[model samples]
Target: MPFVEMSISLEGVSILLKIMVTGKVVAVGNFSRYIEDSRKEAIELISKLLGVTIEEAEEEVNITKGLTVRKAWLKTWWSPNWKSKPFTYPPVQCTERAFLLYLLSYTLFVDKSGSRVSIALLKLLENLDDVGNYAWGATALAYLYCQLGSATRVEVLQIVRYLTLFEGWVYEHFELRFATSNAKYMDQLQPRVSRWIQKHETVNVGDKLA
Candidate 1:
């Protein structure tokens, strides 16, 4: 929520896209089906990316996050604790794509299940140079907006879009006294979200609305 404004403009949405695509998408396709069918190959590529063996990759799919979620876990790709592997050339590109995959999953296009991500997205990373070719900001806006609309139904229990933009918009447009101000905000030249501490998230409810 730090820098994203969620305005109805590319300028705002582009901040969300900065995680990569400087993009990935989900849809019905034969290519996507092919990617799903080749999940083992992906796990193999992931083993190389993580500097682990195939059996280790299978085990890592559960052990890394400690969540036991029975899904594809991407933390090693993005977490700070993991050490970098020494790769000559091609495998390094695989590492970069894996990191992008984590960013995309954890941020914009995160699966509702949280730790899992669709293998189909890996197809986009096959050509790293072309990932940025699409209008990712626009695409994310559309995707988020669609999910938000669907969430308005009475039967809907949750909204799946990136909530940071919406949270930042609320804080920016209205005076929310719950959040602590970041004194060096202007000096940091970060997003408007940098202006406040996230302490507001846990502040107890009261009659105070702002």
Candidate 2:
């Protein structure tokens, strides 16, 4: 679905907001409120749009709630003095696979767009799992590249290779130390990294063997 921008008056001032609407269902920026206010309407809308049963729509709504909670936990986790106050924000543990599926549904199916995952979600995932694990990083990268929509097939393959071999480890081990650190370096380096990966993959094995 396309993002629809609307202007509203608040206290005689104009504020512009972007919302995702599928059919008659509108998902405003405040997801929680939208869910609370239009729970039934949303479920009906989702079921009609996606051709899913109401039960499945309910499940998707629940998964979205989990995503919201996890996002909040991540903000606390990445905050200053997080270690000193480990209990400041308790973790909300759900099946990582479930979260991933919900993320795909929310971004692709519901939003119907390839916008980057919210920063809160990204930070949460980066810290939630072990780097050696492929699910979190791989899924995140795939979503990112999907949003970018400009990566070549070779570039995608290279990014997969790079993440599988190196990037995940760096994030898990070193990047979490500082709150305001270069946490988004990989995103910034995406273009250059894709180029490097493409070049590296194009080399002929026969030439090397010769």
Candidate 3:
């Protein structure tokens, strides 16, 4: 396995994040020679070999290295190519995950400035509902939230609570159902049955629900 070690610093605080690539390497022809190259070169080589954008290739490598059997299975299940020969995952799912990972990777490894972090967070909020629909989506969203600095995490949580009041909807997933619940005093969610209201209102409003 090959790995990349990266450091991100914000204010006076520093954090480290790792990108690991797992699996045996079966290099053919001249490709094997580049294995000993520097990390930057190695990343470029991997990008070219995989025929993916550099960011996409990097995300794929990290996901492949870190993904468990269950996650891989869910990704495969959500993929549009599930019925195709050789199997292919859904591009939309891939793109969404890649974007999330990119945001996380950039924030954790490249820049941790306030403006950059805010932009990334807004992007997450904007796509919050769509990302929640994917298998393991809520988990991914939570992971992204955890990556933020302490204060930012609290702010994001508050924003998520506000969004849940309007945009949240119930799903088959227990995590999501539990998240969007709104029973108030009964250990339910906030705003008192917001998910129920959102569902009914969505039905009544047709496509106007936002």
Q: Please tell me which predicted candidate would have the highest lDDT against the true structure.
A: 1
Pairs of residues clashing in candidate 2: none
Cα error, residue 89 of model 2, in Å, equals 42
Tens digit of lDDT per residue, candidate 1, span 123-192? Answer: 5566677666555556556777888888899998988755554555566566777756767765323544
Better of 1 and 2 by lDDT: 1
Pairs in steric clash, model 1:
3-191
Least accurate stretch of 10 residues (summed lDDT) in model 1?
201-210
Which digits, one per residue and each the tens of the lDDT, describe model 2 over residues 62-140? 7655223222222333343534543432233323422442443343222322222222232223333432232322333
Who is ahead in TM-score, 1 or 2? Answer: 1
Q: Could you say which candidate leads in TM-score?
A: 1
The sequence of per-residue lDDT tens digits that candidate 3 reaches over residues 1-210 is 111222211210111111111222212133223233333343454344223457854564344342111223233334546445565444453445434433433322222331222112222323445433322222222343454434375445432211221232222122454344334423122212223333432211101111
The estimated TM-scores of all candidates read: 0.60, 0.22, 0.20
Better of 2 and 3 by TM-score: 2
Q: Rate the local accuracy (lDDT) of all candidates.
A: 0.52, 0.31, 0.30
